[model samples]
Target: MDQAPGSPQGPQDAPSLPKCYRHPDRDTGISCTRCERPICTECMISASVGFQCPECVRTGSGTGHAPDANRPRTIAGGSITDDSFLVTKILIGINVAVFVMVLALGERFLAETELIGYAYSPQLSEIVGVAHGQWYRLVTAVFLHQELPHILFNMLGLWFLGRIVEPALGRSRFIAVYLLSGLGGSALAYLLAAPNQPSLGASGAIFGLMGAFAVLARRTNIDMRPVLIILAVSLVLTFTRPDISWEGHIGGLVAGALITLGLVYAPRDRRTLVQLATCAAVLLLILATVVGRTVSLT
Candidate 1:
Protein backbone atom coordinates (compact mmCIF):
# COMPACT_ATOMS: atom_id res chain seq x y z
CA MET A 1 0.00 0.00 0.00
CA ASP A 2 1.53 3.29 -1.10
CA GLN A 3 0.78 6.63 0.48
CA ALA A 4 -1.24 9.20 -1.50
CA PRO A 5 0.74 12.10 -2.97
CA GLY A 6 1.51 14.90 -0.44
CA SER A 7 -0.28 13.00 2.35
CA PRO A 8 1.48 13.02 5.80
CA GLN A 9 2.22 9.56 7.29
CA GLY A 10 0.88 8.48 10.67
CA PRO A 11 2.93 9.40 13.83
CA GLN A 12 4.58 5.90 13.85
CA ASP A 13 5.89 6.44 10.32
CA ALA A 14 6.36 10.23 10.60
CA PRO A 15 9.86 11.78 10.12
CA SER A 16 9.95 13.97 13.18
CA LEU A 17 13.00 15.53 14.91
CA PRO A 18 13.40 13.90 18.29
CA LYS A 19 11.64 15.95 20.98
CA CYS A 20 13.75 18.35 23.06
CA TYR A 21 12.42 19.17 26.54
CA ARG A 22 14.16 22.52 26.31
CA HIS A 23 12.80 23.42 22.85
CA PRO A 24 10.03 21.07 21.69
CA ASP A 25 9.71 22.75 18.31
CA ARG A 26 13.44 22.72 17.44
CA ASP A 27 15.44 19.76 16.06
CA THR A 28 17.12 17.93 18.94
CA GLY A 29 20.93 17.71 19.02
CA ILE A 30 22.52 18.73 22.33
CA SER A 31 21.37 17.08 25.57
CA CYS A 32 19.92 18.79 28.62
CA THR A 33 22.41 19.42 31.47
CA ARG A 34 20.19 18.18 34.28
CA CYS A 35 18.24 15.28 32.71
CA GLU A 36 20.42 14.40 29.70
CA ARG A 37 17.36 14.83 27.39
CA PRO A 38 18.21 15.95 23.90
CA ILE A 39 17.80 19.67 23.32
CA CYS A 40 18.03 21.83 20.20
CA THR A 41 20.40 24.74 19.57
CA GLU A 42 17.63 27.30 20.22
CA CYS A 43 17.10 26.20 23.83
CA MET A 44 20.75 25.20 24.55
CA ILE A 45 22.94 27.60 26.53
CA SER A 46 26.73 27.44 26.85
CA ALA A 47 27.95 26.52 30.30
CA SER A 48 31.44 26.92 31.67
CA VAL A 49 32.41 23.45 30.35
CA GLY A 50 29.60 22.02 28.14
CA PHE A 51 26.32 22.83 26.60
CA GLN A 52 23.37 23.25 28.95
CA CYS A 53 19.72 24.20 28.47
CA PRO A 54 18.51 27.50 30.03
CA GLU A 55 16.19 25.75 32.52
CA CYS A 56 18.93 23.41 33.80
CA VAL A 57 21.42 26.28 34.21
CA ARG A 58 18.78 28.42 35.95
CA THR A 59 18.02 25.59 38.39
CA GLY A 60 21.75 25.11 39.15
CA SER A 61 21.54 21.52 37.89
CA GLY A 62 24.05 21.76 35.08
CA THR A 63 26.87 19.64 36.56
CA GLY A 64 26.86 17.59 33.35
CA HIS A 65 28.41 20.62 31.69
CA ALA A 66 31.41 20.67 34.05
CA PRO A 67 34.11 18.71 32.24
CA ASP A 68 36.27 18.30 35.33
CA ALA A 69 33.40 16.73 37.28
CA ASN A 70 33.21 13.86 34.79
CA ARG A 71 36.94 13.19 34.90
CA PRO A 72 38.21 10.19 36.92
CA ARG A 73 39.12 10.97 40.52
CA THR A 74 42.79 10.61 41.36
CA ILE A 75 43.79 9.21 44.73
CA ALA A 76 46.62 10.72 46.71
CA GLY A 77 50.09 9.15 46.23
CA GLY A 78 48.74 7.28 43.14
CA SER A 79 48.80 3.88 44.77
CA ILE A 80 47.40 0.98 42.73
CA THR A 81 44.06 -0.47 43.78
CA ASP A 82 43.87 -3.57 45.99
CA ASP A 83 42.33 -5.59 43.20
CA SER A 84 43.88 -8.98 43.88
CA PHE A 85 42.33 -9.47 47.30
CA LEU A 86 41.12 -12.97 46.49
CA VAL A 87 44.50 -14.01 45.05
CA THR A 88 46.31 -12.63 48.10
CA LYS A 89 44.03 -14.54 50.45
CA ILE A 90 44.58 -17.82 48.59
CA LEU A 91 48.38 -17.42 48.54
CA ILE A 92 48.53 -16.49 52.22
CA GLY A 93 46.24 -19.36 53.13
CA ILE A 94 48.42 -21.84 51.24
CA ASN A 95 51.59 -20.53 52.88
CA VAL A 96 50.13 -20.66 56.37
CA ALA A 97 48.62 -24.10 55.82
CA VAL A 98 51.99 -25.44 54.67
CA PHE A 99 53.64 -23.80 57.65
CA VAL A 100 51.19 -25.57 59.94
CA MET A 101 52.08 -28.87 58.30
CA VAL A 102 55.77 -28.15 58.81
CA LEU A 103 55.20 -27.38 62.49
CA ALA A 104 53.12 -30.54 62.95
CA LEU A 105 55.95 -32.67 61.53
CA GLY A 106 58.25 -31.44 64.38
CA GLU A 107 61.71 -29.85 64.31
CA ARG A 108 63.69 -32.87 63.04
CA PHE A 109 61.76 -33.29 59.83
CA LEU A 110 61.36 -29.53 59.38
CA ALA A 111 65.05 -28.72 59.86
CA GLU A 112 67.02 -31.80 58.71
CA THR A 113 64.70 -33.52 56.25
CA GLU A 114 63.23 -31.94 53.13
CA LEU A 115 61.68 -33.64 50.14
CA ILE A 116 64.90 -32.89 48.26
CA GLY A 117 67.08 -34.13 51.15
CA TYR A 118 65.20 -37.42 51.23
CA ALA A 119 65.78 -37.84 47.48
CA TYR A 120 69.47 -36.89 47.62
CA SER A 121 70.50 -38.70 50.85
CA PRO A 122 71.38 -42.35 50.19
CA GLN A 123 70.98 -43.85 53.67
CA LEU A 124 67.56 -42.34 54.45
CA SER A 125 66.20 -42.64 50.92
CA GLU A 126 65.14 -46.06 49.58
CA ILE A 127 62.21 -45.97 47.15
CA VAL A 128 61.34 -42.26 47.73
CA GLY A 129 64.51 -41.36 45.87
CA VAL A 130 63.42 -43.40 42.88
CA ALA A 131 59.89 -42.05 43.24
CA HIS A 132 60.87 -38.47 44.07
CA GLY A 133 64.09 -36.63 43.28
CA GLN A 134 65.70 -33.21 43.61
CA TRP A 135 63.51 -32.17 40.68
CA TYR A 136 60.28 -31.98 42.74
CA ARG A 137 62.09 -30.12 45.53
CA LEU A 138 62.39 -27.01 43.36
CA VAL A 139 58.59 -26.64 43.47
CA THR A 140 58.01 -27.87 47.05
CA ALA A 141 60.70 -25.71 48.61
CA VAL A 142 58.84 -22.62 47.46
CA PHE A 143 56.03 -23.43 49.94
CA LEU A 144 58.29 -24.45 52.86
CA HIS A 145 59.56 -21.68 55.12
CA GLN A 146 62.12 -22.37 57.83
CA GLU A 147 60.76 -20.22 60.65
CA LEU A 148 57.62 -18.34 61.74
CA PRO A 149 59.09 -14.92 61.07
CA HIS A 150 60.33 -16.10 57.72
CA ILE A 151 56.90 -17.23 56.52
CA LEU A 152 55.17 -14.25 58.16
CA PHE A 153 57.25 -11.63 56.42
CA ASN A 154 57.07 -13.35 53.04
CA MET A 155 53.32 -13.96 53.29
CA LEU A 156 52.68 -10.37 54.35
CA GLY A 157 54.79 -9.05 51.50
CA LEU A 158 53.00 -11.32 49.05
CA TRP A 159 49.64 -9.99 50.25
CA PHE A 160 50.73 -6.36 50.00
CA LEU A 161 52.40 -6.54 46.62
CA GLY A 162 50.28 -9.23 45.03
CA ARG A 163 47.14 -7.23 45.71
CA ILE A 164 48.71 -4.20 44.08
CA VAL A 165 50.01 -6.15 41.08
CA GLU A 166 47.36 -8.79 40.42
CA PRO A 167 44.45 -6.51 39.57
CA ALA A 168 46.43 -4.61 36.96
CA LEU A 169 47.72 -7.75 35.27
CA GLY A 170 44.83 -10.15 36.05
CA ARG A 171 45.00 -13.56 37.79
CA SER A 172 46.59 -15.81 35.11
CA ARG A 173 49.39 -13.33 34.50
CA PHE A 174 49.87 -12.88 38.25
CA ILE A 175 50.17 -16.65 38.72
CA ALA A 176 52.76 -16.74 35.95
CA VAL A 177 54.74 -14.01 37.68
CA TYR A 178 54.65 -15.92 40.98
CA LEU A 179 55.49 -19.42 39.71
CA LEU A 180 58.23 -18.27 37.33
CA SER A 181 59.78 -16.09 39.99
CA GLY A 182 59.79 -18.95 42.45
CA LEU A 183 61.34 -21.27 39.87
CA GLY A 184 63.96 -18.70 38.97
CA GLY A 185 64.85 -18.32 42.66
CA SER A 186 65.08 -22.08 43.09
CA ALA A 187 67.35 -22.34 40.06
CA LEU A 188 69.64 -19.64 41.46
CA ALA A 189 69.73 -21.31 44.88
CA TYR A 190 70.50 -24.67 43.27
CA LEU A 191 73.39 -23.14 41.33
CA LEU A 192 74.86 -21.46 44.42
CA ALA A 193 74.19 -24.19 46.98
CA ALA A 194 76.72 -26.79 48.07
CA PRO A 195 75.59 -30.43 47.83
CA ASN A 196 75.08 -30.53 51.60
CA GLN A 197 73.23 -27.24 52.07
CA PRO A 198 69.47 -26.92 51.57
CA SER A 199 67.56 -23.78 50.54
CA LEU A 200 63.85 -22.94 50.90
CA GLY A 201 61.60 -19.86 50.99
CA ALA A 202 59.14 -17.65 49.07
CA SER A 203 61.38 -14.60 49.28
CA GLY A 204 62.32 -15.14 45.67
CA ALA A 205 58.72 -14.55 44.60
CA ILE A 206 58.42 -11.58 46.97
CA PHE A 207 61.46 -10.06 45.37
CA GLY A 208 59.78 -10.73 42.04
CA LEU A 209 56.90 -8.54 43.18
CA MET A 210 59.31 -5.75 43.99
CA GLY A 211 60.85 -6.03 40.55
CA ALA A 212 57.43 -6.10 38.86
CA PHE A 213 56.37 -3.05 40.84
CA ALA A 214 59.33 -1.09 39.49
CA VAL A 215 58.52 -2.20 35.95
CA LEU A 216 54.79 -1.46 36.35
CA ALA A 217 55.50 2.05 37.59
CA ARG A 218 57.32 2.79 34.37
CA ARG A 219 54.21 2.00 32.34
CA THR A 220 51.68 3.90 34.47
CA ASN A 221 51.81 7.63 35.12
CA ILE A 222 52.79 7.05 38.73
CA ASP A 223 55.88 8.16 40.66
CA MET A 224 58.09 5.16 41.43
CA ARG A 225 60.81 6.79 43.54
CA PRO A 226 59.35 5.41 46.78
CA VAL A 227 59.04 1.92 45.29
CA LEU A 228 62.63 2.12 44.09
CA ILE A 229 63.69 2.97 47.63
CA ILE A 230 61.79 -0.04 48.97
CA LEU A 231 63.45 -2.34 46.41
CA ALA A 232 66.88 -0.93 47.28
CA VAL A 233 66.30 -1.68 50.94
CA SER A 234 65.27 -5.26 50.10
CA LEU A 235 68.38 -5.70 47.94
CA VAL A 236 70.55 -4.40 50.76
CA LEU A 237 69.02 -6.88 53.20
CA THR A 238 69.46 -9.72 50.71
CA PHE A 239 73.19 -8.99 50.51
CA THR A 240 73.83 -8.15 54.19
CA ARG A 241 72.31 -11.36 55.52
CA PRO A 242 74.64 -14.34 55.24
CA ASP A 243 71.80 -16.87 55.42
CA ILE A 244 69.78 -15.19 52.69
CA SER A 245 69.92 -16.59 49.12
CA TRP A 246 71.10 -13.48 47.30
CA GLU A 247 71.29 -15.37 44.02
CA GLY A 248 67.63 -16.36 44.27
CA HIS A 249 66.61 -12.80 45.11
CA ILE A 250 68.46 -11.37 42.11
CA GLY A 251 67.33 -14.13 39.77
CA GLY A 252 63.67 -13.80 40.73
CA LEU A 253 63.91 -10.02 40.34
CA VAL A 254 65.18 -10.34 36.79
CA ALA A 255 62.57 -12.93 35.86
CA GLY A 256 59.74 -10.86 37.32
CA ALA A 257 60.84 -7.73 35.45
CA LEU A 258 61.01 -9.54 32.13
CA ILE A 259 57.65 -11.31 32.57
CA THR A 260 55.94 -8.10 33.64
CA LEU A 261 57.36 -6.29 30.62
CA GLY A 262 55.80 -8.92 28.36
CA LEU A 263 52.41 -8.78 30.07
CA VAL A 264 52.15 -5.00 30.18
CA TYR A 265 53.11 -4.38 26.56
CA ALA A 266 50.80 -7.07 25.24
CA PRO A 267 47.82 -5.70 23.34
CA ARG A 268 44.93 -5.11 25.73
CA ASP A 269 42.19 -5.33 23.08
CA ARG A 270 43.32 -8.81 22.03
CA ARG A 271 41.65 -11.84 23.58
CA THR A 272 42.95 -12.43 27.11
CA LEU A 273 42.78 -16.18 26.45
CA VAL A 274 45.43 -15.93 23.72
CA GLN A 275 47.87 -14.02 25.91
CA LEU A 276 47.26 -16.46 28.75
CA ALA A 277 47.91 -19.40 26.44
CA THR A 278 51.15 -17.74 25.37
CA CYS A 279 52.19 -17.30 29.01
CA ALA A 280 51.40 -20.95 29.76
CA ALA A 281 53.58 -22.00 26.84
CA VAL A 282 56.51 -19.93 28.07
CA LEU A 283 56.06 -21.28 31.60
CA LEU A 284 56.08 -24.88 30.37
CA LEU A 285 59.30 -24.19 28.49
CA ILE A 286 60.95 -22.80 31.64
CA LEU A 287 59.66 -25.70 33.74
CA ALA A 288 61.02 -28.25 31.29
CA THR A 289 64.47 -26.63 31.41
CA VAL A 290 64.50 -26.33 35.22
CA VAL A 291 63.32 -29.89 35.75
CA GLY A 292 65.75 -31.30 33.18
CA ARG A 293 68.71 -29.50 34.78
CA THR A 294 67.73 -30.62 38.28
CA VAL A 295 67.36 -34.26 37.26
CA SER A 296 70.70 -34.30 35.47
CA LEU A 297 72.52 -32.65 38.42
CA THR A 298 71.04 -35.02 40.98
Candidate 2:
Protein backbone atom coordinates (compact mmCIF):
# COMPACT_ATOMS: atom_id res chain seq x y z
CA MET A 1 0.00 0.00 0.00
CA ASP A 2 1.35 3.45 -1.00
CA GLN A 3 0.58 6.78 0.78
CA ALA A 4 -1.29 9.43 -1.25
CA PRO A 5 0.80 12.47 -2.34
CA GLY A 6 0.78 15.28 0.34
CA SER A 7 -1.51 13.14 2.54
CA PRO A 8 -0.59 12.17 6.13
CA GLN A 9 -0.12 8.38 6.39
CA GLY A 10 0.13 5.81 9.21
CA PRO A 11 3.66 4.94 8.03
CA GLN A 12 5.58 7.42 5.82
CA ASP A 13 7.19 5.98 2.66
CA ALA A 14 11.02 5.63 2.92
CA PRO A 15 13.04 8.35 1.21
CA SER A 16 14.35 7.50 -2.30
CA LEU A 17 17.98 6.38 -2.18
CA PRO A 18 20.77 7.95 -4.26
CA LYS A 19 22.22 5.84 -7.07
CA CYS A 20 25.74 5.70 -8.46
CA TYR A 21 26.33 7.91 -11.48
CA ARG A 22 28.07 5.14 -13.39
CA HIS A 23 25.93 2.28 -12.11
CA PRO A 24 22.55 3.90 -11.75
CA ASP A 25 20.81 0.88 -10.24
CA ARG A 26 23.50 0.57 -7.55
CA ASP A 27 22.40 2.49 -4.42
CA THR A 28 25.34 4.15 -2.66
CA GLY A 29 25.93 6.53 0.24
CA ILE A 30 29.43 7.48 -1.04
CA SER A 31 29.89 10.43 -3.33
CA CYS A 32 32.83 11.76 -5.34
CA THR A 33 34.67 14.57 -3.47
CA ARG A 34 35.14 16.69 -6.59
CA CYS A 35 31.75 16.33 -8.29
CA GLU A 36 29.74 15.36 -5.19
CA ARG A 37 27.97 12.76 -7.28
CA PRO A 38 26.95 9.41 -5.76
CA ILE A 39 29.44 6.62 -6.63
CA CYS A 40 29.75 2.98 -5.71
CA THR A 41 32.84 1.54 -4.03
CA GLU A 42 33.93 -0.04 -7.32
CA CYS A 43 34.11 3.40 -8.88
CA MET A 44 36.64 4.53 -6.30
CA ILE A 45 40.29 4.98 -7.31
CA SER A 46 43.19 5.43 -4.91
CA ALA A 47 44.82 8.81 -5.06
CA SER A 48 47.59 10.59 -3.23
CA VAL A 49 45.24 13.28 -2.04
CA GLY A 50 42.31 11.01 -1.26
CA PHE A 51 40.01 8.46 -2.79
CA GLN A 52 38.61 9.72 -6.08
CA CYS A 53 36.00 8.51 -8.55
CA PRO A 54 37.14 7.14 -11.89
CA GLU A 55 36.15 10.34 -13.65
CA CYS A 56 38.18 12.37 -11.19
CA VAL A 57 41.11 9.98 -11.65
CA ARG A 58 41.00 10.47 -15.38
CA THR A 59 40.85 14.22 -14.93
CA GLY A 60 43.81 14.03 -12.55
CA SER A 61 45.76 12.08 -15.12
CA GLY A 62 45.14 14.78 -17.68
CA THR A 63 46.45 17.30 -15.13
CA GLY A 64 49.72 15.30 -14.65
CA HIS A 65 48.72 14.02 -11.23
CA ALA A 66 48.84 10.37 -12.34
CA PRO A 67 52.05 8.47 -12.81
CA ASP A 68 52.27 6.67 -16.14
CA ALA A 69 54.22 3.49 -15.64
CA ASN A 70 54.08 2.72 -19.34
CA ARG A 71 56.19 5.75 -20.22
CA PRO A 72 59.71 4.80 -21.31
CA ARG A 73 62.59 5.48 -18.90
CA THR A 74 65.96 7.02 -19.62
CA ILE A 75 68.99 4.73 -19.79
CA ALA A 76 72.75 4.79 -20.31
CA GLY A 77 73.14 7.95 -18.22
CA GLY A 78 70.19 9.45 -20.09
CA SER A 79 71.95 9.21 -23.43
CA ILE A 80 69.08 7.10 -24.72
CA THR A 81 65.47 7.21 -23.72
CA ASP A 82 63.81 3.82 -23.82
CA ASP A 83 61.01 5.81 -25.37
CA SER A 84 59.71 3.38 -27.99
CA PHE A 85 62.55 2.15 -30.16
CA LEU A 86 63.24 5.58 -31.59
CA VAL A 87 66.70 4.70 -32.95
CA THR A 88 65.35 1.71 -34.82
CA LYS A 89 62.56 3.76 -36.37
CA ILE A 90 65.00 6.46 -37.43
CA LEU A 91 67.27 3.90 -39.06
CA ILE A 92 64.37 2.40 -40.98
CA GLY A 93 63.23 5.83 -42.11
CA ILE A 94 66.69 6.72 -43.42
CA ASN A 95 66.92 3.43 -45.29
CA VAL A 96 63.51 3.91 -46.88
CA ALA A 97 64.28 7.50 -47.80
CA VAL A 98 67.55 6.48 -49.46
CA PHE A 99 65.78 3.72 -51.34
CA VAL A 100 63.21 6.18 -52.62
CA MET A 101 65.94 8.56 -53.70
CA VAL A 102 67.77 5.77 -55.52
CA LEU A 103 64.60 4.83 -57.40
CA ALA A 104 64.06 8.43 -58.42
CA LEU A 105 67.69 8.73 -59.62
CA GLY A 106 67.52 5.61 -61.88
CA GLU A 107 69.88 2.67 -62.52
CA ARG A 108 72.96 4.77 -63.17
CA PHE A 109 72.73 6.38 -59.75
CA LEU A 110 72.00 3.01 -58.19
CA ALA A 111 75.16 1.51 -59.69
CA GLU A 112 77.17 4.43 -58.42
CA THR A 113 75.85 3.85 -54.90
CA GLU A 114 77.08 0.25 -54.79
CA LEU A 115 80.10 -0.69 -52.68
CA ILE A 116 82.49 -1.61 -55.47
CA GLY A 117 86.04 -2.79 -54.93
CA TYR A 118 88.58 0.00 -55.26
CA ALA A 119 90.56 -1.86 -57.90
CA TYR A 120 87.47 -2.42 -60.04
CA SER A 121 87.16 0.86 -61.99
CA PRO A 122 88.26 4.46 -61.93
CA GLN A 123 85.12 5.37 -63.91
CA LEU A 124 82.75 5.14 -60.86
CA SER A 125 84.20 7.53 -58.35
CA GLU A 126 81.35 7.00 -55.92
CA ILE A 127 82.39 3.38 -55.46
CA VAL A 128 83.95 2.79 -52.04
CA GLY A 129 87.69 3.35 -52.02
CA VAL A 130 90.16 2.36 -49.33
CA ALA A 131 92.89 4.68 -50.68
CA HIS A 132 90.47 7.26 -52.11
CA GLY A 133 88.36 9.85 -50.31
CA GLN A 134 85.22 7.70 -50.75
CA TRP A 135 85.76 5.73 -47.57
CA TYR A 136 82.31 6.81 -46.39
CA ARG A 137 80.98 4.00 -48.58
CA LEU A 138 81.78 1.61 -45.74
CA VAL A 139 78.84 3.07 -43.84
CA THR A 140 76.78 4.41 -46.77
CA ALA A 141 76.58 1.07 -48.57
CA VAL A 142 74.61 -0.36 -45.64
CA PHE A 143 71.84 2.11 -46.42
CA LEU A 144 71.70 1.33 -50.17
CA HIS A 145 69.68 -1.55 -51.62
CA GLN A 146 69.57 -2.64 -55.25
CA GLU A 147 66.02 -4.02 -55.47
CA LEU A 148 62.64 -3.81 -53.80
CA PRO A 149 62.91 -7.31 -52.36
CA HIS A 150 66.41 -6.57 -51.12
CA ILE A 151 65.38 -3.54 -49.03
CA LEU A 152 62.20 -5.26 -47.91
CA PHE A 153 63.99 -8.28 -46.50
CA ASN A 154 66.81 -6.27 -44.92
CA MET A 155 64.43 -3.73 -43.38
CA LEU A 156 62.30 -6.52 -42.01
CA GLY A 157 65.34 -8.12 -40.46
CA LEU A 158 66.38 -4.77 -39.00
CA TRP A 159 62.91 -4.11 -37.63
CA PHE A 160 62.82 -7.50 -35.97
CA LEU A 161 66.36 -7.43 -34.63
CA GLY A 162 66.60 -3.73 -33.83
CA ARG A 163 63.54 -3.89 -31.61
CA ILE A 164 65.24 -6.53 -29.52
CA VAL A 165 68.85 -5.30 -29.62
CA GLU A 166 68.29 -1.59 -29.28
CA PRO A 167 66.18 -1.94 -26.17
CA ALA A 168 68.76 -4.20 -24.58
CA LEU A 169 71.80 -2.12 -25.50
CA GLY A 170 70.11 1.29 -25.50
CA ARG A 171 70.31 3.69 -28.46
CA SER A 172 73.93 4.84 -28.38
CA ARG A 173 75.55 1.44 -27.94
CA PHE A 174 73.15 -0.17 -30.36
CA ILE A 175 74.01 2.44 -32.99
CA ALA A 176 77.70 1.87 -32.29
CA VAL A 177 77.32 -1.88 -32.77
CA TYR A 178 75.38 -1.38 -36.00
CA LEU A 179 77.85 1.07 -37.58
CA LEU A 180 80.84 -0.98 -36.49
CA SER A 181 79.33 -4.17 -37.81
CA GLY A 182 78.60 -2.52 -41.15
CA LEU A 183 82.15 -1.19 -41.28
CA GLY A 184 83.46 -4.63 -40.50
CA GLY A 185 81.44 -6.10 -43.31
CA SER A 186 82.72 -3.51 -45.75
CA ALA A 187 86.27 -3.99 -44.55
CA LEU A 188 86.25 -7.72 -45.16
CA ALA A 189 84.50 -7.25 -48.48
CA TYR A 190 87.23 -4.83 -49.49
CA LEU A 191 89.93 -7.26 -48.43
CA LEU A 192 88.51 -10.49 -49.88
CA ALA A 193 86.23 -9.64 -52.79
CA ALA A 194 87.69 -9.36 -56.26
CA PRO A 195 88.69 -5.76 -56.95
CA ASN A 196 86.06 -5.56 -59.74
CA GLN A 197 83.24 -7.07 -57.70
CA PRO A 198 80.45 -4.75 -56.61
CA SER A 199 78.16 -5.48 -53.67
CA LEU A 200 75.70 -3.52 -51.54
CA GLY A 201 73.02 -4.26 -48.92
CA ALA A 202 72.30 -4.28 -45.20
CA SER A 203 72.63 -8.03 -44.87
CA GLY A 204 75.97 -7.53 -43.15
CA ALA A 205 74.46 -5.35 -40.43
CA ILE A 206 71.55 -7.78 -40.09
CA PHE A 207 73.98 -10.65 -39.67
CA GLY A 208 75.80 -8.60 -37.09
CA LEU A 209 72.60 -8.28 -35.08
CA MET A 210 72.13 -12.03 -35.22
CA GLY A 211 75.64 -12.51 -33.91
CA ALA A 212 74.98 -10.03 -31.10
CA PHE A 213 71.77 -11.82 -30.22
CA ALA A 214 73.59 -15.13 -30.05
CA VAL A 215 76.37 -13.74 -27.89
CA LEU A 216 73.97 -12.03 -25.50
CA ALA A 217 71.91 -15.19 -25.20
CA ARG A 218 74.96 -17.29 -24.51
CA ARG A 219 76.23 -14.88 -21.86
CA THR A 220 72.85 -14.80 -20.14
CA ASN A 221 72.79 -18.65 -20.06
CA ILE A 222 69.61 -18.64 -22.11
CA ASP A 223 69.07 -21.56 -24.50
CA MET A 224 70.93 -20.53 -27.65
CA ARG A 225 70.09 -23.50 -29.84
CA PRO A 226 67.59 -21.48 -31.88
CA VAL A 227 70.00 -18.62 -32.38
CA LEU A 228 72.79 -21.00 -33.32
CA ILE A 229 70.54 -22.80 -35.76
CA ILE A 230 69.53 -19.55 -37.41
CA LEU A 231 73.19 -18.48 -37.59
CA ALA A 232 74.17 -21.82 -39.17
CA VAL A 233 71.43 -21.53 -41.75
CA SER A 234 72.55 -17.99 -42.60
CA LEU A 235 76.16 -19.10 -42.89
CA VAL A 236 75.15 -21.95 -45.17
CA LEU A 237 73.20 -19.52 -47.35
CA THR A 238 76.13 -17.13 -47.47
CA PHE A 239 78.39 -19.87 -48.71
CA THR A 240 75.96 -21.48 -51.14
CA ARG A 241 74.44 -18.34 -52.65
CA PRO A 242 76.52 -17.31 -55.64
CA ASP A 243 75.59 -13.62 -55.37
CA ILE A 244 75.92 -13.23 -51.57
CA SER A 245 79.02 -11.61 -50.10
CA TRP A 246 80.18 -14.26 -47.63
CA GLU A 247 83.14 -12.10 -46.58
CA GLY A 248 80.89 -9.25 -45.49
CA HIS A 249 78.54 -11.59 -43.63
CA ILE A 250 81.31 -13.30 -41.72
CA GLY A 251 83.02 -10.03 -40.90
CA GLY A 252 79.85 -8.45 -39.57
CA LEU A 253 79.03 -11.51 -37.51
CA VAL A 254 82.43 -11.50 -35.87
CA ALA A 255 82.30 -7.80 -35.15
CA GLY A 256 78.87 -8.02 -33.56
CA ALA A 257 79.84 -10.95 -31.38
CA LEU A 258 82.99 -9.23 -30.19
CA ILE A 259 81.22 -6.00 -29.43
CA THR A 260 78.47 -7.74 -27.49
CA LEU A 261 81.03 -9.84 -25.67
CA GLY A 262 82.69 -6.71 -24.34
CA LEU A 263 79.34 -5.30 -23.36
CA VAL A 264 78.28 -8.45 -21.56
CA TYR A 265 81.56 -9.37 -19.85
CA ALA A 266 82.62 -5.96 -18.66
CA PRO A 267 83.28 -5.81 -14.92
CA ARG A 268 80.66 -4.06 -12.83
CA ASP A 269 83.24 -1.44 -11.88
CA ARG A 270 84.07 1.03 -14.65
CA ARG A 271 81.71 -0.91 -16.91
CA THR A 272 81.03 1.96 -19.31
CA LEU A 273 84.69 2.72 -19.76
CA VAL A 274 85.46 -0.90 -20.47
CA GLN A 275 82.69 -1.15 -23.05
CA LEU A 276 83.81 2.06 -24.76
CA ALA A 277 87.41 0.87 -24.83
CA THR A 278 86.38 -2.45 -26.31
CA CYS A 279 84.44 -0.72 -29.10
CA ALA A 280 87.35 1.65 -29.74
CA ALA A 281 89.76 -1.27 -29.99
CA VAL A 282 87.48 -3.03 -32.49
CA LEU A 283 87.22 0.11 -34.65
CA LEU A 284 90.98 0.63 -34.62
CA LEU A 285 91.52 -2.95 -35.67
CA ILE A 286 89.10 -2.58 -38.56
CA LEU A 287 90.78 0.67 -39.64
CA ALA A 288 94.20 -0.94 -39.47
CA THR A 289 92.96 -3.86 -41.54
CA VAL A 290 91.60 -1.47 -44.16
CA VAL A 291 94.83 0.53 -44.30
CA GLY A 292 96.98 -2.59 -44.58
CA ARG A 293 94.78 -4.03 -47.33
CA THR A 294 94.83 -0.74 -49.23
CA VAL A 295 98.63 -0.50 -49.04
CA SER A 296 98.86 -4.01 -50.39
CA LEU A 297 96.63 -3.03 -53.31
CA THR A 298 98.82 0.01 -53.97
Task: Give the candidate number with the greatest lDDT.
Answer: 2
Question: Candidate 1 on 93-143: residue-level lDDT in tens?
Answer: 888887888888765555443424223445444433212454666677777
**Model 2 per-residue lDDT tens digits across residues 215-274:** 755643346787788889989989997889998999999998898888756764676898
- Write out the backbone clash pairs for model 2: none
Candidate 1 residue pairs that clash: none
Q: Give each model's whole-structure lDDT.
A: 0.64, 0.74
| Model 2 lowest lDDT segment of ten | 71-80
